[model samples]
Target: MDHIKKVGVIGSGTMGAGITQLMVQNGCATVLFDIDKETVDKAKESIGSRLERLVEKKKISTEEMILAKELLQTTTDMNMFKDCQLVIEAAPEKIEIKRSIFQQLEKICAKDTVLTTNTSSLSITEISGQIENPRRVAGYHFFNPAPIMPLVEVVQGLQTAPETIEVLVQFAEGLNKKPVVCKDTPGFIVNRVARPFYNEALRIMNDQVASVEQVDRIMKSAGNFKMGPFELQDLIGIDVNFATTQSVHASFYGESRFRPHYYQERMVQSGSLGRKTKGGFYNYD
Candidate 1:
């Protein structure tokens, strides 16, 4: 963790920005990158606002917030990541896009710099296969709302080195996150175990066995889960959740247990992508 004084995060979306905030809060000099200057700037502003809210809530001192803001740097250039000891690619869940970003990072970063992906379901080995040093490529899958999520899946690809995994585990702990090591399996651990939670809820709603609200209510009251499947999907983005289910299902060669519900596809196609779009199983509008 001491060796990882600087970090870089790509994509500048919700997950990327969250990871950047976590890094800076933990005293790492962080560079948040995106292709669009406007997008990166927006992410920077959003992170700053979140830090301010934490200070207002007394979760963080004003001085801590100031230091965190100072530690953060936003950029539209990929070359700015050249000196980062660790780079976490929070790009979209596309194999080609992730691979391309890693390939570009391979050229820009130092040979020993650890490269990780925040992919929920993509194969880490495939993402790093084309790069020169696959041993340095691993998965650092943080849950949504990274600053609040305690568990981080430190995934080891077939080619990933033991040293790389150790470094990631220590780094995650340094960020005050609980790190669990897992192999480079599709959906790794949490997402794999959680598929049934979302899939069966969708199935129940699709079969008219229960309404979305009913299912969520039961899960919260009887199942004792913090958030019901439908509610969680809305928070996670219906499209993102559906895509993860599809990826896991396909990865298992169309296993029935991991099958996605048609209603999820319909929601995604309709562009009611959970809270972000103001609608999904429930409407925010």
Candidate 2:
């Protein structure tokens, strides 16, 4: 893939801010965008604090951290992204919201510029189709804490060009991330493969096979996972997790195996999303 010197990241949430920090740390000028000025300012502050912590831990030199912060620009204008080589949208998961951002990005960005979405659940095929040049649009889903996560899912939609995927594979690798190319299906790879983990765990709990704590312990010891399903769910946000499950389940047209459990729905419905709220399936409070 050709060199990507400038990156535009839409949204200021944990995922988006982390992406900006990582891109800048890798020597790319990153422009971060959000709808509101306050959100952008908060994101900037969050990134600064994170970098400061890294410096304190001796993970990065203080000078390097300052340079990384200098490389990051925060903005609310989509027009600012016109010069970006690759623009990654990390906006909310709503399809309409993403489509709107794509429409705006297509208008502001050049024809050769690649438009990528960091959408974990939605279909890249559908998201790309909403834009003018679907061939140039693709999924570039990153795991939570993008700066630290090793894996990146480089998904190609039905109409995505091979060169686009190739570009991203190199791009992700340059960021010190392992990129895995996959066809843009419902949940793609990791999400699909990992679905049964959460679903079956819920099923087992409901069936009295084990309690949530026992299931987590067993999975961690025997399954060799850093975190069990319930623990991971709490960390990822129950609402966000449930939404992804629902999206995948819906994308599969209500396949029984992909069905989301009501217990998760209850967690979301009750507004007990997760760690952000200081509680979830396993209470943090």
Candidate 3:
């Protein structure tokens, strides 16, 4: 497996910043890109702060943190990704946005540069459908808190080459993430298996069977899970979680099981999007 030395992450949002931090910390020269200069600059600051925290905690030395920071580069220009051996599209989960990014990347990067999407539920095949090299396009879904999350779903689109899957699996492992290969499917694996977890919790609350806090408590204690569905939703962003449910539901052709609850939609509409917004199922403020 070829080792990916230089990586590019498109979008400087939460996932994008986390991925950039992870790459640089793992010794890869990383380029973080966003259309907005301010957003990208803030992301770099956030990444730096996180590394400082790790240094304070003794997880990494001062030298290591300095080296990681040195390896990171932030840019508002998409053309800066030309030299990246692997470019992960951590842009918004919208299919059109992802398609446009991959299309643009195809023109900017080398033919063999692996173009991967961090979309949790969007169809990888559809996103890369119009790209010149569909085989190089695959889904590289990472959980929230990319540096800490161990599981990475390596999704193979219908046209994704076997070599592409192999490269991604190796790259993911190189980053110390556990990679699971799966065919293109709605919600892939974790999100699909976990959809009912959130939906049912919302249903129970909506039906007055339990309060939000009560539901989370029960799941953590009874289910032996680290976090309850509602609490997890708050961390993952209500809008993002809701969008995944909607995507899976549509992919399954309105399957009742994957249906998104209106309460979640209402939270999104209300702009109570979770930790970032300081409010969601539970208030951070």
Candidate 4:
């Protein structure tokens, strides 16, 4: 862990920004990369504003915020990752895009530099299959709002080296997150085990068995869940949740247990993609 000082984060979007913030806050020099300068700049601004709010609440000192901002850098070049000891790719959930990033990273990164993905649905083994050193590729799945989410699934691909997993587990711990090791399986742990929550709720709603609010209330009251399925889907982005369900269902060869509901797809198509879009199951507006 001592040797893993400089880190690189690809994709300066929501998850990328959060992960970069986590790395910098924990005293690691982090480089945030994106396709263009504009997106990177916006992400930096958003992260800076968030850190300023933390300073206002005394969650972090002004000096600490300043240092974190300084420790974080934004880049439009993949070559900037040349010096990174660890690089986490948090790009969009597209396999081809991830494959291209890994291919480029292989050309720029050191042989021993650890590479991981923040993919919640994609297969880690498949993502690393074409890479020069598949041994270093693993999954470092973080939930939405990465800094606040405590659980990080450290998925070990079929070809991933044990030492790579050890370093990532330690790295996640360094970020003050709980790490769980799992094999490279579809949807990994949380997403795979949690399929029923959203899928069943959608089924119930579609079958006219219960309203979204009613189901949410029952789950919170009876199931003791902090938030109901619809609520969680909204928070996680309905589109993102839909993609996961679709991926898992396809991975299982159309297993009925993991089949996605049409209602969820309708929400995604309607652009009611949860809290991010101000609407999903329950309207945020």
> All models: lDDT?
0.94, 0.90, 0.93, 0.93
Better of 2 and 3 by lDDT: 3
Better of 3 and 4 by TM-score: 3
Please give each candidate's TM-score.
Answer: 0.98, 0.96, 0.98, 0.97
* Superposed model 2: Cα runs more than 4 Å off: none
Clash count (model 3, backbone only) = 0
User: Compared with the true structure, what per-residue lDDT tens digits does model 4 show for residues 1-285?
Assistant: 888999999998789999999888889999999999999999999999999999999999999999999999999988999999999999988899999999999999999899999999899999999987899999999887898889999999999999999999988888889999999989999999999989999999999999999999999999999899999998988888999999999998999999998988998889999888877777777
Q: Write the per-residue lDDT of candidate 1 for residues 255-277, one digit (tens) a residue.
A: 89998888899999999999988
Candidate 4 local Cα displacement, residue 28, angstroms: 1.1
Model 3 C-alpha lDDT per residue in residues 1-285, reported as the tens digit of each score: 356788999999989999999999999999999999999999999999999999999999999999999999999999999988999999988888888888899999988899999999999999999987899999999888999999999999999999999999988888889999999999999999999999999999999999999999999999999999988998988998999999999999999999999999999999999899998988898
> Mind giving the per-residue lDDT tens digits that candidate 2 earns over 92-199?
899999988888888999998999999988988887776778999899999987899899999999999999998999999888899999898888998898889999
Better of 2 and 3 by TM-score: 3
TM-score of 2: 0.96
**Residue 188, candidate 1: C-alpha displacement in angstroms:** 0.6
Query: Which candidate number has the best lDDT?
Result: 1
- Give one clash count per candidate, in the order shown: 0, 0, 0, 0
Answer with 1 or 2, whichever has the higher TM-score.
1
